[model samples]
Target: MSTTTLTPKITMAQAINTALRDAMTADDRVVVFGEDVGPLGGVFRVTDGLTASFGEDRCFDTPLAESGIVGMAIGMAMNGMRPVIEMQFDAFAFPAFEQIVSHVAKMANRTRGKVRLPMVIRVPYAGGVGGVEHHCDSSEAYYAHTPGLLVVTPATNADAYGLLRAAIDSPDPVIFLEPKKQYFSKEEVDVTAPVPPIGRAVVRREGRDATLITYGPSVPVALAAAEQAAAEGRDVGVVDVRSIVPFDDETVCAAVRATGRAVVVAEAPGFASVASEIAARVTERCFHHLEAPVRRVTGFDIPFPAPKLERHQLPGVDRILDAVDDLQWEES
Candidate 1:
């Protein structure tokens, strides 16, 4: 069915909440549970009003145990229920790492197709909220590394609604990482509109000089840099890779090849990150089309810094433009 409904402007968090309410209303088997998800509506209030609307069975709270939350969700999925479990914070999810990596991720394959774990694990991630240690880690690479998980992160309000809906309905387990930084960022979104497929990347802007490949929270930064580049007479394109696990290489490589230069950006540290994988793939596929080596604008290789120090650690407009500036000096 077409998910086409015109709606007023809204924030990413609001779009997500709409998706959850819709999912619960559409399917009785669908359920949501996490710490404070019922009463507090989650730390960000993304699940706010769900309990009042869907009642305790559909929208409820779990113990403060991450592992138990995931493990129980896995069991529920196997028993013919679709469970959407939330991990309150990014770092807080690590406590359930064993269940995720060992069980939830491999359940389908482990049962040799006899079982399907249709579950969604939601995590609020990344810095910019002035959050403490466990609150702002970009742990996407860890889930992307797992074999059986479908990892997705949405940058805009529309994608947030569409992708969250898609994730809840997916036959496999999904790690839906919500960029905390972009939660309050607003846009006009139609919750009923047809959403793009889960893994396809979208080119937010077009250009001829260079392409800025980014996803999640860093998408806005890349787009801002592109605008700045345009003012300086440089045509810089921007691609939002909405999904991390499937990693849209075709769209990204095509954009880079057309521009002949590319910069991959991510808030995660540079060492072995999603940005690194993007750089490698673009280089391999668009090797002959490239005029310069692929560059990455990412967080530092150290731990997530203190709140006040994040501005310097995270990639910004200047950092992205600097990478683009480097591309100009390279020979064709």
Candidate 2:
């Protein structure tokens, strides 16, 4: 006789909530605080019930000042606490940029390794849920560009739980970008399951003709485009670049080299963006293997537009397919 273990099907938001609860339960040093995070349970309720489970001292709300919230987290981290603070929204995090860059990022290095800041700054980012101006923005590039910080984002529900747990465990500070658009997306996940650590990338689909490399919210879009390309007789692969800071060059270059054609897809603008960096890296490492120049399917170089005009700025399935078509395929 054999027994079967079952995993619970959960949304990305719930997975995040579970991660927080488990982390707090395991470590008394772990705390959760942000705007509307306590009694209100956050704007998306990702922090819902955390306050109820941990009580006010462990899970409480803060004022609307983003800088103060981050500053306080930094102070707590320096004093040996693992803080997981939320920024409320992607754009709202700008006000705390100084604290992140000057203090949180540079603390350990500035102390010559005498200090380690175990902290996670959570930012709900990217467009898709018809959010207004300050709510939807892809700000990963800024954190990725900064040194001494581990920048990571999750594309699926399991990753949402796993990555958050890993971030909470890190001794170095982390910029945890949660794709708000995928918050409600569901998947069967075991909260106790181990996932790839930070600084690794995973290939979501495998193929030989071409590769679509993306992360966060664009992972689903790339997968959809790969499916459509399959129907059209083109075998395209998809790579989810889960970590932006410590990019997995081995996995990404391998995928592009295998196909000899590639397109970098992202929700941020193409200019001087993470997409641009990946394309350049592929060219630098896999230049001889390339059958064509690497293409990019990314958002326009403008502020995130209103809900009505967002689709025009975001990379979509049709746009990704068009980019794959431009990869200089031989005429049959």
- How much is the lDDT of residue 79 in candidate 2? 88
lDDT of 2 by residue, 149-215 (tens): 9999999888998999999999999999999999888887766576569999999999999999999
lDDT of 1 by residue, 207-242 (tens): 999999999999999999999999999999999999
Residue 193, candidate 1: C-alpha displacement in angstroms: 1.4
TM per model? 0.97, 0.97
User: How well does model 1 score by local distance difference test?
Assistant: 0.91
Assess candidate 2 and give its lDDT: 0.92
| Each model's lDDT | 0.91, 0.92
Error of 1 at 173 (Å): 0.7
Task: Name the candidate that leads on lDDT.
Answer: 2
